[model samples]
Target: MEDDMLTCNSVESPGPPFLDNAASSVATSLRRCANDKLPVSDNRDTTVSRWRKHCPTPIENDNIFEIETHCKDPELCSTLACDIYKHLREAEAKKRPSPDFLETTQKDIDTSMRAVLIDWLVEVSISRKKVTEEYRLVPETLYLTVSYIDRYLSSKEINRDKLQLLGIACLLIAAKYEEICPPQVEELCYITDNTYIKDEVLRMEASILGCLMFEMTAPTEKCFLRRFLHAAQLCHEGPALHLEFLASYITELSLLEYSLLCHVPSLIAASSIFLANFILKPTKNPWNTTLSYHTQYKPSTLRDCVKVLHRLFRVGLGSNLPAIREKYSQHKYKFVAKKYCRPSIPADFFQDASS
Candidate 1:
C-alpha cells in the first residue's frame, strides 16, 4: 500500500539521438479558443504567485475550520492532511515545468504537436487496440506521464518523430511511479507498435530521470483532486459517486490542454469540482464555504479556470481527441462525459463568496 507515488526504479543509459540538445521556442500553432491563454503570465507562473489568488476571500460569515474528519481516518494518513498540502503548495512552485518552455527551451514542436501527442497518449492508454485491462494505466499515471513530458520539453528540445518516443517513455516512467504492477518496457514498445525497441525506451527513461533528477513525485491536479474530492463529500448529500467521476473526467480533459499551464494544479482541480457540482446540481451553488476553506480559493479566483473548463464541457468532445470522452462515456465511469453543462452558468454563481 504505497502512496500512489512511492514507486519507480531507473537505469543508467544514454537516450536516443532524438532528444537532440537543440533549442526551438514556439507558442500555440493551433489555439482552441480565443480566450485560450497559452503563455504562463510571469505573475501567475508558480503555485506561489504566493497563491495570492488562491487565498480564501471573506465569505458571508462563518468560521472556517480545519478538515478534522478526514484526519480521523488512519487510512487517509490523517496526520499529513494539512502538512502534505502545505508542502505540495510550496513544492508546486519549485517543480512546475518552465512556464515558457515553448518560448525558451523548446523550439522544435508547437502547441499543436503537443496537443496531438497528449491526445494520442490518452487514446492509446485506453484504446482496445493499444492496451489491455492488465496494462491499463491509472489516471494518476497518465497525469504524471504528461508532467514528465512537459518538464522534459521545458529543459530539452525534441524533433517531431522523437516526440512520440518521449511520450511512451514518460508513460512507462509514470506507470512505474503510480501503478502497483506497471507495464513492462517490452509491452510499452509493443504499444508503440514496436516503433521503439526496449533499449530505446530505457535510454529515454534514463534521460528523463536525469533531466529531472529522478523527482517524479511532484504534485499534480490528480493528486490535489484526491484530497479535494474528499472535501467535496462534505456536502449535505450522501456520497455522490457520480460527482467523483464527473470531476475526474473534467480534470483529465485538462491534460490535452497546453494553455492551462497558467493555472496551478490545485486551481485546476478546484475548477473541476466546481464544474462537476454545477453539472450534477445546477440549481444549487457549486462552490461553498467548505470547498473554499479546503481549496483556499474563493469563487472569484475560480472564475477564469472555471470558465475555461466550462467551455470545454460545453464544447463536449468536438476535437479529434475522443479517448477521454470515450473512456468516461463507458458504464464503469457512470457516463459522466456524456453528461454536459449548459453553455453558460449564472453570473451570480461567481458572486456569492468573493464579490
Candidate 2:
C-alpha cells in the first residue's frame, strides 16, 4: 500500500503548535497572580509595573519541569481547566457558521442528493477504518471530514459529478489535519474505485483549502462531545458505555441532515447527550449542575435542538443511510445501534425542567 500511494507532502504546514503552551502560560500566570506573591513596584510608568498589575509574577523560571509541577496542583489545575474550556468555547463561537450559512445551498443539490453523497462517503470512511487494524483513524477525523465537505458545499456550487471528488478532497484535508499518517492520494482514489484521479484529488484539495481560507481548525461536534461526555460521566453512576454509544449515534445522525448544520457544534453535542440520557433512563433528569456548568446548556435550552435530533433519529430508522447504524451495531461499538429503541417520548420531554 505504501508503494502504491502518493503522499501529501505539499500540503502546507498547520503552523505553530503553541495552543497548549499558551493555555498553560495563562493558567500559571493567573495562579500566581491570585496568590498575590507577585512583586509590585512603585515605578508605575514601567512595563514591569503594567505587567505586575496583570500577570503580577515575573516568569523568571524557563524550566518546563517546574511549570508542569506547579500546574499539577488540583486547586490550581481547576483554574487551568476552566481556562481551557473558556478558550475552547470562544474559539467554537468564532468558528460557528453564520445563521444564513445554509442559504448558500447549491441550486443543483437538494436534500436527497446530499444524503446519497453522505451515505457513500460514510462507507468510504468505514473502508479507511478497516485498512489499518492498529492506529485506526479517530472518529473525530470523520466528523471533521464531513464538516469540511458541508462547509465547502454550502459556500460553492458544484455539479453532482464532482461531489465524490469534493468528498475525497475534504477527507484528505481532514486526515492531514487530524491523523498522524493520512492515507495517500492514491489510496483515497482507489477507495472511490478510481472515479477520481490523483491530480483531480490534489486540485480539489487546493480548491477546498482556498475556499475555507485554510482554516481547518474549526471546532467540531466530536470535540464538544468528548468534553460533555466527561462532564456527564462525573455525574452519572450507571455504566456509561451505553450512554456514550447512544450519544455518539445521535451525533452522527445529525451529520446527515443539512438543516442541522445551522446549529452550533456544542449545541448538537449537548443535545445528543441529553437525548441519549433520556433513552437510557427516561425517568431521571439528564442535565445536572456539573453538566450544565460545563456545557452551558440547561435542559430547557437544549429542548428545541433535542427535538430536532429526535426527529432525525426517528427518520433515520427507515432512511437509506445505514452506515452509521451498521457501524455501531457491531460488537466493538457495543452494538448500541442494534439496541436502539424508539420508545414513546413524553409529551413534555422538551419542556423546561424548571417550569
Candidate 3:
C-alpha cells in the first residue's frame, strides 16, 4: 500500500542525541524517580534547563541525543538513553510510520485496560476545563491534548504535577492544528491559569511535535462519521441534528479519557454515530447496518467500537452528560425547542456546566 502521507514533507526533528552507556544503570535511575514519585517538574525542569544551557543553538535534525538527555538526567544514563532514542528515531524517520500509532487499535490495548484509559481521560478533561478558556472550539480539542500525555507516559515516568503543563502545550498545538483562529501565547498562559511560562509552552510544543514525529492525522468524532454518513446516505437534517448531539456528547466524553491513538478519525466519528443512533432510535432494529459497511476498512469490529463508546458515555459523561435540562430548565433552552438556543444560544449555554 502506498502511504501518500509519508511522501509528504513533515520535518519533525528528534532534537539531539545521547551517549552510549549501560542501559541497566539508566533503568535503575528512572526506577528510583518512579518509585519515589519524584515530582515530574523536578525531573522535567532539570532536563529542560540543561537543554537550554547545553543544547545546540538552532538545533540540528540529527542532534537527538541532547534532547533525550532532557528526558533523563543521570549523567551516564542520560547519555545511554539519548543514544538509543536517537537511533530509534533515525530508523523511524527512514520508515515514516504514522505518529498516532498509540491509539491506532484497541487490540494493542488489552480489553481490561479500557476502563483505566477512560479514568485518565476524565481526570484530564476535568482538570483542563477548570483552567481552559471558554469558546475553545470543539470538545475534541482536548483529545489531542490528552494524547500527548498518554504517548509520553507510555515511555516515560512523568509525575502527575507536570501533567497540566503538558496538557496546556498539547492544547496549544491542537488549537493551532484544528482551529481557524488559534489562541495567542498570552491567551494560553491565561487558559492554564498562569501555571506555566510562555517559554515552557513553546518548548513543550516543540517536544510534543517531535515526540509524535509531527504526525497528527488522528480522527475526531465528526470527522470519522461525516464520511461514513455520506456513503450510507444518512445526511438529512434530522440525522444531522442527532449526529451533532451525539458527536458533541461523545466527543466530550472522549476528552475525558479517550486517547487520540486509540481510534482513527473515521472510527471515532463512526462509533459515536452508532451510539447516538442506538440511543435516539431504539426502534430501529439490527444496528449492524450502521457499522457493517466500514468493517472492511477499519481494524476494529463495529460491535467492539460501539461497546467501547457506550462504556465511555456511562463513565466519562458522569450520568447523562451534565443534562442541560435539569440544571438550566427547558424554559431557558426555550422548552428544548432549539429555537432560542438553536442558532444563537445564550453565552451562558456553554458557560454553565450543562452546556
Candidate with maximal TM-score: 1
For model 3, state the Cα shift of residue 242 in Å: 2.1
lDDT of 1 at 277: 93
lDDT of 1 by residue, 192-311 (tens): 788989898899999999999988888999989998888887673734789899999999888777778888899999999999999988888988888888887888889998988988
Candidate 2 has a TM-score of 0.74
Clashes of 1: 3
- TM-scores across all candidates? 0.78, 0.74, 0.48
For model 1, the superposed segments whose C-alpha errors exceed 4 Å read 1-66, 70-72, 127-133, 236-239, 352-354
Highest lDDT scorer: 1
Using TM-score as the yardstick, the better of models 1 and 2 is 1
Candidate 1 or 3, higher lDDT? Answer: 1
lDDT of 3: 0.47
Model 1 lDDT on a 0 to 1 scale: 0.79
Total clashing pairs for each candidate: 3, 0, 22
Ranking by TM-score: 1, 2, 3
Candidates in order have lDDT scores of 0.79, 0.73, 0.47
Model 1 Cα shift for residue 178 (angstroms)? 1.6
